[model samples]
Target chain A: MSIRYPNGKKFEKKRIFSGQKNVNNKDDRFSNRGMSLEEDINETNDYYRAHQIAVIHKKPTPLQIVKVNYPKRSAAVVTEAYFKKPSTTDYNGVFQGKYIDFEAKETRNKTSFPLKNFHEHQIQHMKEVMQHNGIAFALLKFSLLDEVYLLEAHELMSFYDKQDTNRKSIPKKEIEERGHLIPFGYHPRIDYLKIIDKMIDRC
Target chain B: MSIRYPNGKKFEKKRIFSGQKNVNNKDDRFSNRGMSLEEDINETNDYYRAHQIAVIHKKPTPLQIVKVNYPKRSAAVVTEAYFKKPSTTDYNGVFQGKYIDFEAKETRNKTSFPLKNFHEHQIQHMKEVMQHNGIAFALLKFSLLDEVYLLEAHELMSFYDKQDTNRKSIPKKEIEERGHLIPFGYHPRIDYLKIIDKMIDRC
Candidate 1:
């Protein structure tokens, strides 16, 4: 019933998010366009895990907890904490003997995907993954268009290196030409692994 | 200067761990045996990551946070949370173009390692990794003996299955004969990767 936080604090139970009213329609929950890129990817990963097809997971958001309060007969409360930047990509796991790693991002822009969404450390992490021969890519979800693209890290890095002189965003045309459009469906939602299988075949 | 926790609460700065006296000698910090097995592995992982040897990481402990308190002008603090059992093994990464997954545990028992130390999900996760042709193993640290052993998951599973009728522990003698003894040193403390290299060569 109780849990310990990383800083050894007892996390007590409290009700938050009471402002949002409940949606009675179950179908609306599945088709909600308001879902974040992380939520969509999590759903896809859950499907993959349930079917024994792949084992992919989003790394937990790193936190630096500073203060904890232990009360008698109650769960410990984390009185203070801060989020920390993660060193690795958001998602990583194994599929068919190969290591798969990727970051999922959502963009509101209809024409281009901004490169500023990624940090230097994340790009460096992707480069290291490629150096070790693991499959590395990014899941760019265009919220306005409802389209998802699986772009290889090498392609992203190539454009990133040119950002100093060229445009700071990847043009949609360029992404369409270089990246594989991940087919979205009901079960196993994103089906990015299918594209990965093809990529492995080509390699 | 500040960061947010998952819950919406102001995480004000506070001082904890005030009881521990500071050590003046910095060199003694690295040689401290008070380091937990998790800490040692984390240090080893840091060294590996810095040198670009391997990208192994210890997944953060999973927590299911249910409540938060958000105060104006401060980071959110998680008021209530529950610890969730992880669905997969602790450590996993790519090394030498191969997917590597393993769990690390330290035991005080001198003669045998209790099978109860492993969860059913962890064993199942390792089996799935092996089924996909990935290298899966367990790093068992005999704390009393100051020794570590890298035992393959297949071997561990065989012993685990016999727990119903046989003794619910892996005898140290059997482990000594079957598991590879991991060499320990200063720079890259527990060199379990060396054992992994040997395993890869045989494959």
Candidate 2:
């Protein structure tokens, strides 16, 4: 629901390319085919819904609307609104009869995923979900490496708790040991649910 | 999340009383209390969260932003936006290890509840949730009578399916026969999880 990726260089690059139009070369146009992590996961959810596999949705970004103007013969227009920090994770829904909640984030850093990518409230939200028997996890993407990992909420929170000390991030080796690598596929793109299936089986 | 109750009189009444300033009598101020069904449900969800009962959230109203402007060193302002119809129900969450999804609606009609309170997609959403073994229902309120009922999604869809030819509304008598009454309380206001607990037991 909330896009808190901030103005990293990768975000800037995507924003810059968003306005590029009329480039008609077939292969050249196809070369920019892949989307951001959020878009890919959205499409994955869409695929799941269409195939009757799962029904998940990304919540809309919350906005503190200050003012709205209803123009004559037209729809209401939001004249002044500020983006509000979301109280919960961005995406949540029913999957395999279970409530699944997770936050997705991508970092361009090669060796570590910074704890700064997450807010304290989000970790606490995840903890609540886990406590209530809901599936909670983080979909961490290494943008440059094109790698994704599903870190269980408890593991992520454990690493986050240690951020009070000098350790400010989860190292790639640690993540590799603790998290499940979500293999990329064509139809659903990133098949994270496969990891969840394994998790359920292990449980 | 989407407010589709078009020109509802109860809604109008609430809007008119929203800005009253100089009312000092404690009883008078307290008398003009009680909120919309959505607000009541939101407060109930907050209470649930605080008590570690459940983690439910009403999705935000989706908006299609056509234009945005960023002034120097200020947050981006939406210049033009339109409300988008939501794909799913207003409220969904995990309760007691099960995914629960429902739409809440209130009507003034004492005899019957109109089927048009719901959209085709919303009914379809509920159907999908039920197919996935998720708990799905409608929290229906008869505002003038001050009564509420939890109609299972199956019962609701059965009524909705008949709307194509005749019987565009569900009689309140039938609702009472098929739906569970949700008793209002002082703390959580509408204690929906009680009905859900019964549902789980029956299953």
Candidate 3:
């Protein structure tokens, strides 16, 4: 599936060409693909914030900053820091009086999105958001196909809970059947709020 | 004019010892003495967010990242960056359906809070907020007396506008007479919502 921006500009998937012959190219993973999913989501978030369409932002990675160096006549630099476990989803904010929360991920696999893409902490975070009556979802981008799908957290949780005995990955067809396809746009890029409106209407 | 925490803990005011001369002392003008005003306000905001009382946060300083190093197997590290000119106040969020925006500052001067403590961009930002029907204000702390006040942006603008011919600072006595004193509390620490409640009531 191909995605088109608001002005009819088509977004093509980026490919990596390497000279190394012995490199394992058959194994597909997000990190190995070189295109950062976080960066793209952040860009889309900035577009949303600038247009006042939404106020979502990625929470700063929690850090336990232990020591700082106060160099002579300069800004203090953090010298020693460690990452701390995050208690919430990566992105959250208010949009039109509704609390919105979501996590974004990309996968290079052509057939399925792996259940391992999410963590236990993130699952728990989404559960808490659901308990609080907040809208929670995940943006899954099939990088190779240039398609983005907004999958509700409830749907994801159902798949996650059966991961131990069932298939370790969710088929792409399942997502297409159950998830909302988010179209890219000019002003807000990923206009997820359109999907949000539908979800609220259904509720 | 002295203030104490809700638990009755006295805030310690930093003092310059007589005859202690050092180059670092010259740099103290820009540096926070101790328990930074920004840090304290952030803590207060944390309290607000956790309790669902409000959703305020300091905007991350916009940075023009110049150089980034991409290691073979590590996350990208920003090596050099500089702050961009911000077009809005440092802090903003929603409080009970009202958009709230504010800047925070601390002064050691006993008689007055210097107008120079504020930046031109901050003033412009507050003006824009007012134009959008947003509540704008400044949280000023007098470090010498451990007192904090919520001074409305309009009151600050009036003082700032007269600074060309009048004194360059707002007298402490005037602030005491006009500004809303923020009471500290065990849960919220700054308890700024009391002043916000009064503002909403007036509206």
Name the 10 consecutive residues with the lowest summed lDDT in model 3 chain A. A16-25
Docking class of 3: incorrect
lDDT of model 1 at position A188: 71
B1-203 per-residue lDDT for model 1 (tens digits): 79876562222111101111111122112222655566678789889888888888877655555556678898666555544567788888888767889998766677988887888898988888887778899998776577889999999998998887569889999899999888777878888888888777887
> How does model 1 fare in lDDT?
0.75
Cα lDDT tens digits, model 1, A58-160, are: 8765555555566889755655555456677879988888999998776657799888778778898899889989999999877668889999999999999
- Per-residue lDDT tens digits for candidate 3, residues B69-140, read 556897445545433455556676657656677887777777898887787877966765665466789998
lDDT of 3 by residue, A1-203 (tens): 99875662222223321111111223333343343556556778777656666656665554444444557898545444444455556676656556677887777677898777777888876765665566789998876777789999999999888886568888999999999888666555577878898777897
Per-residue lDDT over B76-136 for candidate 2, one digit per residue giving the tens place of the 0 to 100 score: 7776666777788989888987898999877667799978788788899999999888999
TM-score of chain B of each: 0.82, 0.83, 0.80
> Distance from true position, residue B62, model 2, in Å?
0.6
TM per candidate comes to 0.80, 0.85, 0.59
